[model samples]
Target: MDTLSKLFKNNIRQYGMIIALVVIMLLFEILTGGLLLKPINITNLILQNSYILVLAIGMVLIIITGHIDLSVGSIAAFVGAAAAIMMVDWGWPTWAAVVASLVVGGLIGAWQGFWVAYVRIPAFIVTLAGMLLFRGLTMIVLEGQSISPFPSGFQKISSGFIPDFGSFGTNMVAVVAGIILSVVYIINELRDRRAQLKYNFKVISQGMFLLKLILLVAVINVFTFMLASYSGIPNILILLFVLIVIYSFVMNKTVMGRHIYALGGNEKAAGLSGVKTKKVTFWVFVNMGVLAAISGLIFAARLNAATPRAGTNFELDAIAACFIGGASASGGIGTVFGAIIGGLVMGVLNNGMSLIGLGIDWQQGIKGLVLLLAVAFDIYNKNKRSV
Candidate 1:
């Protein structure tokens, strides 16, 4: 009982948001009269929020390092415009255009990074300037117009699904993939438990661990089943899953990750401890730029057009997701998985309200409230820890 209490208290924030997410879904499910969880609606939910999720993944890392990128929305818009121009106007292959756009994104990140790291400018100021700069560049590139009807292959990046092996009612691919993911998750958990035991680290009891594994596996399989019932797995979902796994691993297990946390915790202390604070900050923004570019491409493909005003208010969504997911406003604390949850929370809220005939005005007010409460929760936790 003591151990359970300790675990619950230690993970209240993590568990709290998760519980909140489930509750929100249930409330919406009840209100929407089952429309919220229908397979088709579920698929639409994923598709509509994929870009924000992408930005949140990258934005979490930035926040972890005690910085924010106000320019990501504009960067995404700019990259989408550049890619559209390459493919639509210059007649470049879709693959080449995408690669070039990503590189361009990296350069843009590097540009902002240089100012923040080397020049010691505040990230807020630098990225705020970038927001204006890139938004203008996006307009110039598109000549204040929308570009459309990209190549079929380019469009598939956002709208295509994994191939169905048969015309059967259920998609065998999704079902099989779910099983594989469940097995992988279980095996990974077991291995981690063994490692903890070897290191004399605190570990959950076998019963609880097993229960967790079972619950998580059930959820995973159920989610996949829903997808299978719809149009099978989306290609963009595969992209998101791969990115989450990779970023989660990188942040949790890498030396670079350690450096980032240390830097965010205290810059002077980290520098004295032999950390390259400038380099890490630079790289983090570069990564953000790349992710923004990918998100931009996906967004444009989804809309089948690139507009001058694309990506408006995107930075707010990404920033809100990070904070809502438990990233500290002051930094040095966050997780990739947490950011994903936050994005999903926003996604569900938007989808649910829209489904229930809510107006955009009310939706904005509610989202603002959610974000405020989340940050307040964080502050409460911080004060409690200090006490």
Candidate 2:
């Protein structure tokens, strides 16, 4: 009981949001008469939320360094417009267009990174300027028109699904993959537990650990099953998964990650500790630019059009997801998994409200309320910890 209490207290934010997500899903499922979790809706939900999720991943890193980027939405829009022009107006090959778009995104990031890192400008001002600057550029590039009908191959970047060579009704491959992942998850959990014990670290009880594994495994299988029911797996979903895995690894296991956290926790101290604060901050923005570019492509591909307003309010959503996902406003604290969970919470809320015939105005109001409450919850936790 004591161990359980300690564990719960330690991870209350994560556990709380997860429970809230399940409750939200269930409530919507009941309200929408089962439409919320339908295989097709679930698939659409993922497709709709991919860009925000990608941006959230990058946003969390920036926030962790005690900074923010308001220009992501504009960056996404500008890059998408550029790519559209490359493919549509210039007749560039799809692959080359994509590469060029990502490069453009990187250059944009580097430009902002220079201002924020070297010039010692505040991130908010820098990104705000960038937001206005890039939004105008998007309109200028597209000449206030939307471009459409990308190559089918280019379209696949966002809308394609994994092929299932062997399936009966549902995708058997997805089910098998789910099973394999569950086994792997269990192995990883047990290994982690053993390592903690070997290090003489304080650990949860055996039963608690097992219960945690069981719940997570159930989630993995169920999530895959639902996706398998409609389409095996989306290409974007695969990309999101790969990204989550890579970023999570980078955050928890790498030196650069440590420097970022340190910089966020205390810029002066980090610099004194030989962290190269400017370099770290600069690189983080550069990474954000790349991710934002990637998100722009995903959005454009999903819509099959590049428009002037492609990424309206995207920066706000990404920032909101990070905060709701348990990222600290003060920096030096957040997780990739937490950011994903936060984005899903927003996604589920949007889907649920739309299905229940809620008006867009009300949806915005409710989402804003939810964001406020999540941040309030974080503050409460922070205060309690300090006490």
Candidate 3:
């Protein structure tokens, strides 16, 4: 019975996100008069929260190490300004401008990381300083004006979707390929379960495991059908999927990823055990910088312009999503999947509130209440465990 109780606790810690997502979906569905789960809104939810989810993944890693980055929104703003200047003022090619923007963002991250990791500055102080510094630079670059009319190809980075293979009469070949891919994915998952059991790792019950697998498969097929029914899927969505897969693998399978988690869990212990905390911290910021640059580019593309205020309050959204999704404020406790779920919850809340004709003030008020409740619940859960 104790073991069962432990299992339940573990599942809640690990899968609280999935539960929250279902509850939010149900609530929104009812609130929207059943409009919340319309296929289009579901797809819009994914696309709209894409940037927040991306930032939260990196932010959670930073927080795991007991650090917070208050400067990402500013960094994103700076990137937007720089990208605008590159294409408009400097007349750089679209690809060159994109690469340059990312590099500049990385340098900015490296600058901040150096101070925090090597100079031994507290992260909060260093990032606070960066927030002010970068915001100032952004205003200088933009000179209080917005930039627009980027090259056509550049604009496509955010706004373009993949062409429908079904446009040529429902390309049957793609359907067959998808089925084969689905089968392979299922087999791989089953093999992973077998491997875990063979190693005597704690595993979910067979019934629970099967249920999860089926649900995942169902979700995938439903998404595929939606795209197949429309103008195929989005290229940006495909790229996002690739990135998530790669990052997930890095976090779950690679040595560097292990070290990051270790450092987050206990910095002194990680350092004593030969993990290079300095290099890890530096690169974590670098990764965050790159993701921020990409997000800025996407935002610019979506708006068809780069505004001076493009990223205002974005960091708050990302941080809130991370915390709401189960990342502890004290750090060393979060997951990529959880962060994604959290972003979705926020996205759903925003969409549903807007649909219900709630004013911005009311929406913000409700969101603040939700954030307070989520964090309070987190603290209570931790205390209960300690007791």
Candidate 2 lDDT tens digits, 71-162: 99999999999999999889999999999999999999999999999999999999999999999999998999999878899999999998
Question: What's the CA RMSD for each of the models?
Answer: 0.9, 0.9, 2.3
Q: What does the lDDT read for residue 292 in candidate 2?
A: 100
Q: Write the per-residue lDDT of candidate 3 for residues 1-387, one digit (tens) a residue.
A: 454467778757447667877888888889889887776776676667777777777787887777889888888888988999999888999989999999988898888889888998988999889889988888888888889888888877766666544446553433554566578789999999899999998777788778877887777676566555444555567667777778778888999889988888888999999999999998888888888888778778777788878778778888888888888888678777777777777888999898788999999998898788889988999998899
In candidate 2, how many Å is residue 123 off? 0.6
Q: Which stretches of candidate 2 lie over 4 Å from their true place?
A: none
lDDT of 1 by residue, 155-245 (tens): 9999999999977899989999999999999899989889989999887788888889989999999999999999899999999999999
Worst 10 residues of 1 by lDDT: 1-10
Give the TM-score (vs. native) of candidate 2.
0.98
Q: Where is the poorest 10-residue window by lDDT in model 3?
A: 165-174
The 0-to-1 C-alpha lDDT of every candidate, in the order given, reads: 0.94, 0.95, 0.80
Model 2, residue pairs in steric clash? none
Q: Which stretches of candidate 3 lie over 4 Å from their true place?
A: 1-6, 168-181
Q: Which stretches of candidate 1 lie over 4 Å from their true place?
A: none
